[model samples]
Target: MSTSPHILLITPPLTQLNTPYPATAYIKGFLGGRGYTVTQADLGLELVLKLFSKEGLRRVFAEIEAGPYQLSDNARRMLRLKQSYLNTVEPVIRFLQNKDNTLASRICHSRFLPEASRFDNVADLETAFGTMGLSDQARHLATLYLEDLADLIKETVGPQFGFSRYAEKLAMSATTFDALHEALQAAPNLLDQMLLELADALMAKVQPDVVGFSVPFPGNLYGALRLAGRIKQISPATKTLMGGGYPNTELRTIQEPRFFDYIDFLTLDDGEGPWLRLLEAISCQLPVASCQNEQLADVVQNNLATGNRQLATHQLQRTFLRNALGEVEYHNSPQPDIPHAEVGTPDYSDLPLTEYLSVIEVLNPMHRLWSDGRWNKLTVAHGCYWKRCSFCDVTLDYISRYETAPSTLLVDRIEQIIAQTGQTGFHFVDEAAPPLALRDLAIELLKRRVTITWWGNIRFEKTFTPDLCRLLAASGCIAVSGGLEVASDRLLALMEKGVTIAQVARVTDGFTQAGIMVHAYLMYGFPTETAQETVDSLEVVRQLFAAGIVQSGYWHRFSMTAHSPVGKNPAKYQVAPVGPEPGPFAWNDLWHEDPTGTDHEAFGPGLAKALYNYLHGVALQEPLSFWFDFKTPRATVPRHLIQQALQEPGKPDAARPNNRLFWLGNTPELRYEAGKKGQQAVLTFFEQAEDFEVKVPAPLGPWLQTLLTSLASDYDTKVLLKDAAQSFPTAGGQKWEQFLLSAGWLTLREKGLLVL
Candidate 1:
């Protein structure tokens, strides 16, 4: 057997999909590179799949019948259809898994699958989108079927149940350790029972020396701790560690002694460096002095003075360790941050890929991307390139410090991922992909001849030119989504987004023209945003859709985060901090009251309703005041603002060169040949640009070559055409010019310009 200690990395319950979150994969890749044995599990997806099964539903119904809990009307109705649900749950699951095509016909034809009050609006959705095909309808209905079962579990077992988040409300905005402690101490719910049973099987299988739990969200906290608590109870000698987004953010200032009872160590920031140091300490390779921080050394000396003999010899830097006195002590690490290029490609070899279920929750076009298919999640960089947004977590290292790997290395990692997972789709989970980096990546991908579909987040800035968008599309970019937060020029400038509404319209239009789908991340209710601004923002959104620059968008209410610029200086934004002021457990999303006195809260429903209708191509001509129920001021925005902005005026007599030939992977060639029928004119257009070649009039061939060469020289069309007038006869030049204009050989920038 290898001497290296076994490590088991786990993802807790309630993160969406069967795919493991990228955190475990990152740590696993790093540790594997360091020559240690690592095993990983995605318990979140496993538990969800296990619970939604026919047998699981049977057990759930039995628990519901046996328990003393009160049932909601929906839960009571589900009990009445218990037998039908038990019969159909397995088929629905198999259909979702793509294992049974025969069941699709049946599912589409009959109402055999049970529905719930949660799905009472399915009819409304169908009516709104028009009658979709049976496959889509079945998928929607099947989603509702699973949701109905989930609802029964929620109403009877745990009130905080959700497909992706369980007991989230209990953890959200939790200020003190006492709330989490009491929640952990509460009687186990049905979901908890299922998680414990799953954990029991996994622990028995892996039997790891060190079990690390990855808690990426507040909702995952309760589940992770509960699992750790069970591991401590069953196997007291096994060391338990917790780290990820939640602990990295919330547990940084933790002082709770009870929190360390189940977990021996809690790491912060990027887990790779700390994990290696921890393993070294555990293996007795790290010297005592090297492993110790001043605070931790003081705790250790104090414990020794108290005559404690059970203290472990292991010590860790950059981690919270438990001493003999049962107190958690933080140790600072002297290690420098690891370069992102050296972190290695995320490994997914240990995850079960085929078992993941693709869930469809909403019929909305924009919402389906979340649950539609499996996407390989990779980060293009370590942090945001533009971290100056006032509402963002600019103080956090994950956002503040931007670092990126070389384009060649990124493509190499992409190839490695394709070889490992046999999947060619990717989702770059970056805060905002830097434009220069994306351009370099697109070029490298083309040079390497790598074919993979990908999309990611970006800032709506001018760097994404029409040429760059087309190049990206040629390199297999299918869609892009970016923040267009608060859509008011004044608020945008205040937020330091670095892009105005006009710039956003132009950028989105570029993407659209390149045949890439566009989705906007919209925000409302920023500090000092009056009712008039909100209405005007909606007006701009309406024009963006009407002009067909953006196909989809989402509206989120502005939130104050602890690490944001606004949070650091509240008075700057004319807001005062409210209660739940930074405590030990959670330090995110600080509540604040805006002195501007606008009811930002009430704007959410109307904005959402209006955007929803806009997405479905409805009510575009309605007045801005139609969305809001309460009397709102009329929008002061000019109706033609977005249209004029999107129709950007070009320099007089200027022609923007189309890079389509470059994207097609070849150069154009023209040939003139005399035929046997008495010097007949023939022009042959041949190259590897596409699969086919075309023949044009011979008279047009020389003019086309001249235009292409002129475009390469970057000369304006007026200047080039004036030069061309001296070379060809008037009649021949006119015919060739008409052909070039009509055949898309020459593009004029001024004809379609919209004037406001």
Candidate 2:
């Protein structure tokens, strides 16, 4: 090989406005670790920055005025205020990038930012934010202001224009490649031209031998192919590839030869194995047939027949390539996927870490985390530990194959990421972060003094005790989200979610009590879900919100997918598949008619309305029927169900002796204070917000002070509960067990003492 092929990874337009999607960073890190020259770009962020600039607004206004198109009242209003938008666009963008903070009060005023139809939601804006945060309120207003320009663009130049997605409708549920192919074949629109120009400029600069597009969402699919087409035309020698969330699930059964015209290679599941093997083939400059031997094909066929994925690691993993005969060929290697520990820390070097815009679409505390700030995205582990959820694509490799890295390695990675990004906010993009691993990682972060604010998804398992939640919060975990899908116990059991409504209530309450906000992923319209069950589910959610157990939540409509258990065995769930039949391209997201379930479409709006009110702490006391126009069954759930569950005391600290004993507060300073017994020993804890002191007689105080020192997170040795109990010093015949019930111990417990 002349030289190891220079690889370029691009995150296509568009995904998030706040943070760069972790897919490319992850791939770049692993590949860079392997001694490859890998550079990366976030075209999504680039496009947003370009499209929202002063010059960009001028072009948009020009296009709208010149085009022969009918304008909505809002579009006309924005057109009338064109100069206002042009003047404020650049400053507003800079402000959103966190480069300007003095403009918040001005934007909060009536006339600072240009207003259009998007400003009509003034009532909801005021209600949602009140006067709590001046900057955040300004951000919300600026978001709407930008959205007004987006509306004008959609009406005049680019019909598919969106803040987070472009031409997404063409790719969503696109069972065939015809629509996407046709769009790519058509002349580029103003937006598409801008995307291509940006891609072309990057390609010219990098001049890479291979261009890899990370198509994480359906919206990204079109842009990836469009960019690939441009790269093929301008630099014919360069190879192209596609991977990430979209192809990992949707394009597994691809049979379209036209699809390969844009991308030479496409990978599924984790990219580590397939990418290494593909690079080997590219180094040899050989075709697909020359690369994959006959025995490898035999192994793939054999594995498929037997439903076995664990095989020899020498072959190319799940990949799609076009052969010399112009036919599609699929190759799945027998080798095991890379271990999670070996994937290396996600590198954010090539990405513009500071240029991303932090747009605020939602105002609530837990909800705004998604779109309001940059988060260093990392995965605690690979795959879901519990992959039995019927509605999920449990059969997919991304979920079925489970692996974990040690907490020490995870903390090392976390520290490395913080050093690279200079941002301490992390979003653990795990399917479900293991509780024990999080518990250990929390301890490691505390031990190393690596402070970061983080959040992640998890199953509401009973293992997340109040003490564990406290440990996580101390480690800077500000929020957590878990699926409380279809709150009916029967539906939960049917879906194999392994969590009941009562368990969710208890878990969410533990997080809330520990000062960590919780967001529940609510689901509706599970197979065989009756009207009564649906109404009852709403009641459970209401109770969760009313009791202040859950701070934020969302309702999701269930869609059976081809890889899910329900799609595989619809008879089991009593649902029938409605046919569009599998086409020559995309194949996930199966259409189904749940004959045994209620009219799910009818309940969607009502469920959404009720949730919208619940999110803002409004209309919570209203009757269930008040949310819907149609007569609905009364909720059968008891009013106190959630409260009762929250009140249920879990196992006490005395029951778990093997658990680690930790001191999160400051180290105590020992001194003598005047007392009845001449001079008693007093220990003072100088905490950040407040300071407190405890006094005890003579030897007991000195011994307790030494124990607290050893229990501090900075200490190397761990002190177990049983060992700590055994070492307790008795005073006035106060035994070890008696000391546990004393005010001194309880006060210490309240002041950051943790038995985890």
Candidate 3:
């Protein structure tokens, strides 16, 4: 070896239970090829388990016994309520209770925490942190949820320190840890001792040149900073770098240089470029500023300030990043392509990869999806094309950062994996696999006759025709996942989602016809969504399912992410500001609301349950292919029976809530194998398809009528409407009203429609 100096790459645990998968592997590949010995540590997960380890638990229990900051019975009750998800996240709960990290169970606990209620308000967070006595950094970090902790680190530390480099997301994970923290009190000194012990172990064994900490989420922030401090205490000479999501977004406002005492460098933007540059500078004994120069600093500043807007709309003003000397900077070059192939096979040997958590061996959503066989995960592309969906975070990394790997390169990677693992199935982990790349990939797979099964995310566009879908299916493609954010056309337009509802229906039908499974992403509670509009969304879901288009769906409450288009331009989507106390990721939904005080009830539990029922097949009027594919049971009498049960001129609400067709077999106690309790439980029909069926959800019937009527009202002069001159009377009045409502012509006040 040339003694060229080695670097360690670390992915801080975004969630307590998640491991660093793609991040460590990809970074190892890039740096290892460049003569840098890179070591990655998933300290986030380690710390999470440490919290519940025997030692960890002893410390926590001791603290509770001592009663730090007056944590009374009420506080304990609240904490217990938060941790009520113990049954679901048993591994993590037990691990936390143990509070020891040396054990294998602790390590396993790092990969799976039960997800539940997120922090709601700044006060709620203040109370949480207050109970724990967290320092300022930890307090600030509590704002982010577990899923995004890594990215938050990148945003906060990287930008705050002024290291203006960008790298692609080497990893993608969806694990969250807040639910586990619900029952625990933050004990800073106890956590510090555990981290010190872990750090000492690393120094004794690995003797790594530099130890990097990946604190990607807010929940992990206190733990990350504490761990970073402990690492330094153990090995003073070993350099420490903090990167990931936290530093990327919040770095701009964090002015305290004291935070840098433990962290030598903070990587901003994408870690791949900046991290490599920082390593070179450190190894070569060059001034850190020389790596960024001045021009690049300016561009980095502007880019960080404006995010994707700088890349998409205003790059012409400064095409090349410039420094103080007016020299162009290339350190941050190749600003992450969303559709690129692996530069090389991820170096997983160094990581405790096999030792990390595996969901497949057990039963989970991922396992259920792969019940036929196990499959490896791979990314065909990165970034997104239709990043224009206002709800997306295209701006944070810069929109237009679209890139696709060559078909040859992708195939090579797949072949190498198949050969190595003796597995033929792969998961394409792209944000939205570009249409052209998908087509090219299909063509190449066919040409090479690579008999590998795969599935990935893609945009719901017209380009995915029946023939194309068929070709993909023939080429071992199994499922298609894409976001259909809202069912209302007006809301869709407001979000700048280019695809139309009709097009979505057609494309979904095409995928279904081609035997491709589809899992749609649905969002409720956008800024402009009125009570009727929200209801109308359910109607659209009902139609999509009844039409045999959608196979299944993942419904989410709409969130204005810090870097997404909608988050940046809230006014465009009618989002008004709530009081400005930052809380948790879930609080993003609370930012927007109706100021007129007319439709807040639309956001209540009823609509949420109604939509949940529909998505889970509890409210289905007809059995779609998705229900059978998921092996979900029908719970109540079929639609025909329900219709028969409905007496003429009678309302359905008169029936008992749980006795309704949708809730027949579904009880509060039911849970999914994924440990996703209420969220994942499906409404099953007991025996015959006719024994349980759902009605056309209340939202759709009304919204459809509104949309049509609004269309007629808007274009009345252009079309000859016989009813425009007088009171419109006909059997289709309700249909017209549904269309009109969805079309945005009538309001609740004007139509005098009762709120559901």
Candidate 4:
């Protein structure tokens, strides 16, 4: 190896539209600490920028001419619209909330939209500019609009809208390829041409010695491969390394050696330690046997089995580490062969710190839940705990366990980060937020008076006793997000969520009492969920609200992820494959084909409105305080209309009703309906309304009718929310219902229906 060869670190793009922690920064921080000259380039954000460029568009458009590009206008429009829609952040979030497998499957297919990408060999400038496809004027217009908007943004927001060197590379690996594919199909090989142009700019403007690409998402696997192929072709001398989520997760399954031919080398695990070692070897012209081919096979096998395994401590030490407070351990440590105490703190000097600030509009979204009012994303602690969750891909990239540093070590890392970057807040990007680690963290933070704000994911456990929660809050813990999965005890048992409804209620209450905001990560559409169970889950949530135990919430449908426990063992979960497999689940339909699948109706069925209503905090507007408020008419609303207003946005005000015409028409006495006493419940609610007529928009009548129809359909049988076609909005069913009730349009006593 040439003495002191220049090394380039790249971070693949991620889902974050704003700035995200770069892979290279972690590596570069490690390498730089070891006295190596490392430069970072984020290709992910660059890909997004390319989407806005004329040169990028023209090249892809031209390429379409050389291919079999027959597609319907609707499909093309869908493609273009999806691309544009991706510019915003909501679609991705909304997509994640949907549970319909049929819709998800169609979306998965559409990810390979036009199917033209496979035809172009290298997917390079020549291929991109030579393909044959229809003239996509709409795609062109979109490109122009985005570009103009980007320009205005740059001018108004300065570099804040751009990506850091590390963030750029991350985006390139994470999102660019997909974005390119969408653009290319709509036009031509715009993705390739854009890369070529960017390569030139980098070569001319930055003149870096090496170029690495981080490939994080499996959806981006193909595009990343093609982009790497093109980059290698353009600059033969520039070293190309492939790392990130793909290699880390797929290390074991990499049967094709040809991938090695395209990229010079592959890095895995945390990459920081290995990366630092490689840089040192290169800098000193040392023959490093560790990174050689003979050892690669073993590395691959171990990584694949471990799935997102963490780096060894010896590996960590080879890079850099600093600051220590407590001991660290790995739960399911992948590299037991490695030590932890020896690893050094990562170096941050080699990264382009300024670039990250441009795109950071606000701190990470989760930070908003914290009372400390600080912004932070995650650092280290990458994978999840309980990787074996039925629906989770535990055996996938970065989901495996790593050696966790002691609380002292964590504090040290945070202190170092604060000194170097002045980032005082943090978001521990963990899967389960293990109780032991939290206990240790609280001890350390309290001891050191870290004076920083933080938040993270946690499982609902009795360990979150009132005392522990109170201590956590005092130690700068602002909020905790728990994946309650489902509210039904039976469903919870089936999914192995480990927490009971009672436990959930208690834990949530504990957090709330401690004054920490609670954001619940709920899942509906579990394979065996029945209609009654779905409604029961809603009731549970209502109970939680009544108890004043939860502050905020988010929900998702159960998805069978690739390599996940459930995905691997579908039958164990009573989930039979009723349709084709779904694409990689993204908050948005990143790789989806039919944005709206043909079988979309089948996915929502009868539960769509209910699901939607539940998420928006309106399902059964009875807050945990509902009991106390019920007596005073403070927590009630016209429950029927809540579902209607949510689905039909800005519904014509014409639906305004004649409040005087409607009333709680009552018969002599309340009567219970068989075992359930359903009729009596209605009578009690009507009596509470005190002859008040509920006024709702005329358009909502249909929604009420549909809800009643679904309820009747379920009658005595347990109908899972998954089986229903419609989901209700939380805002509509909960908040709006409360509004009407509080407005005295509905009452609790008249029908004996109001439980509160």
Best-matching candidate per TM-score: 2
Predictions in order: lDDT: 0.76, 0.86, 0.49, 0.47
The true-versus-predicted C-alpha distance at residue 449 of model 1, in Å, is 2.7
lDDT of 4 at 10: 56
Worst 10 residues of 2 by lDDT: 286-295
Q: Give candidate 2 misplaced runs (Cα > 4 Å).
A: 124-127, 130-132, 286-315, 671-682, 695-699, 713-715, 730-732
TM-score per prediction, in order, is 0.87, 0.94, 0.57, 0.54
Candidate 2 clashes between residue pairs 3 or more apart in a chain or in different chains: 311-334, 312-334, 312-335, 313-335
Best by lDDT: 2
Please report the TM-score between candidate 3 and the true structure: 0.57
Per-candidate alpha-carbon RMSD to the true structure: 6.2, 5.0, 19.8, 21.3
By descending TM-score, how would the candidates be arranged?
2, 1, 3, 4
User: Which whole-number lDDT from 0 to 100 does residue 112 have in model 1?
Assistant: 74
The alpha-carbon lDDT assigned to residue 640 of candidate 2 equals: 91
Which of candidates 1 and 3 is the stronger one according to TM-score?
A: 1
Which is the winner by lDDT between candidate 2 and candidate 4? 2
Instruction: Single out the weakest 10-residue window by summed lDDT for candidate 1.
Output: 747-756
RMSD of 4: 21.3
